[model samples]
Target: MGQGADHLTSNQAQVLDHLRAANAPMTAYQLLGRMQNDRGAVAPPTVYRALKALEEAGLIRRIETLRAWAPVATVRPGVVVICDDCGTVRGVEAPGLLESLHERLVAEGFAEARKTIEVHGRCGDCAEDRA
Candidate 1:
């Protein structure tokens, strides 16, 4: 993780640490609050700059729907999963999933640029509670 921080500025490292410690996804504003509360001297622009660096490094993902972010698990490859019901986000490893989809798109004469897979439905706890 130190090596990852080496590529980022001090502020970015701090932001990444906060995101990694969080139990749930956090918005940039939430991160800014955390920085201000914890560091007591950090500025808002610092938080945003850090977030941008982490996003560029693929060390974290921004949840478009919720406009929040969650740390990428060390064991998982880069994949984002968003829960529709509670708006919780999780990361998983589905290595070839995107590649296969892109291939199929090309076969159908459609050029795929970017793809965001948002599976909408109740999460396990929510489903069980409803049942």
Candidate 2:
């Protein structure tokens, strides 16, 4: 379990483990399927609840555009770079960038703004392949 995840339920920890092992984002249903395949007959609600808890605890992030979830790779503010071609999602840490972004938002009168920025582009390997 992660530092903050010491209080997670068993199911939530399992979900977090699966997400950490995954190379890309996974939808809730997909997680359920994996669990069911491994352990048999896990309910959809069970997985959904676990996901909710994990997300709330900052152990995971939801990719709104893809409707998928990814493990939080760091404690910094969430930023994900999605590979449009291969569907790879990689977390990135940019505290300075996040601070500037929040500053800009505050300047525009957006109060207490929290952000999860998703940038879509080809990844290095994919770009090299294309080249």
Candidate 3:
């Protein structure tokens, strides 16, 4: 939820703000540049620290496939779709069916499904370009 922004550490808030504005996943180095351009110089470790904190808080998520990060618009269960050709990333909220599946998994002895799924493919733009 957007209200959770109030609970983040200063650096985490800054990173989340930047990624929310970005509207797409970004690598740590790219975020570093954005931070420097917007504020004064910042170290990579500082950004990584903020990122780890934000990830743990569910305020943001990492696209492990791309090694990039993006802000989580909502805390609800969802999936990350990535454009394999252009590296574009989009987060989609899972429908009720997926929720039901997760519930079934939990019933079958799985832990609460907090992990978001990641799917990679050529996005519409890239597909159209190929055509």
TM per model?
Answer: 0.75, 0.86, 0.76
Q: Write the per-residue lDDT of candidate 3 for residues 46-118, one digit (tens) a residue.
A: 8999998887876877877778887777323477887778766777777886879788998989987366588
Task: Give the better candidate number (2 or 3) by TM-score.
Answer: 2
lDDT, ranked from best to worst: 2, 3, 1
lDDT of 1: 0.71
The per-candidate count of clashes, in order, stands at 0, 0, 0
Name model 3 segments beyond 4 Å from true: 7-10, 74-76
Q: Count clashing residue pairs in model 1.
A: 0
Best lDDT among the predictions, by candidate number: 2
Every candidate's lDDT: 0.71, 0.82, 0.78
User: Over the stretch 77-120, how does candidate 1's per-residue lDDT look in tens digits?
Assistant: 44666667666666666779877877899999998765666555
Query: Which pairs of residues collide in candidate 2?
Result: none
Q: State model 2's lDDT.
A: 0.82
Q: Tens-digit lDDT track for model 2 on 1-131? A: 35466588889878888888888888999999888887878998999999988888878888988999988773235678899998888778787887897888889998864676888989899989989
lDDT value, residue 26 of candidate 3:
82
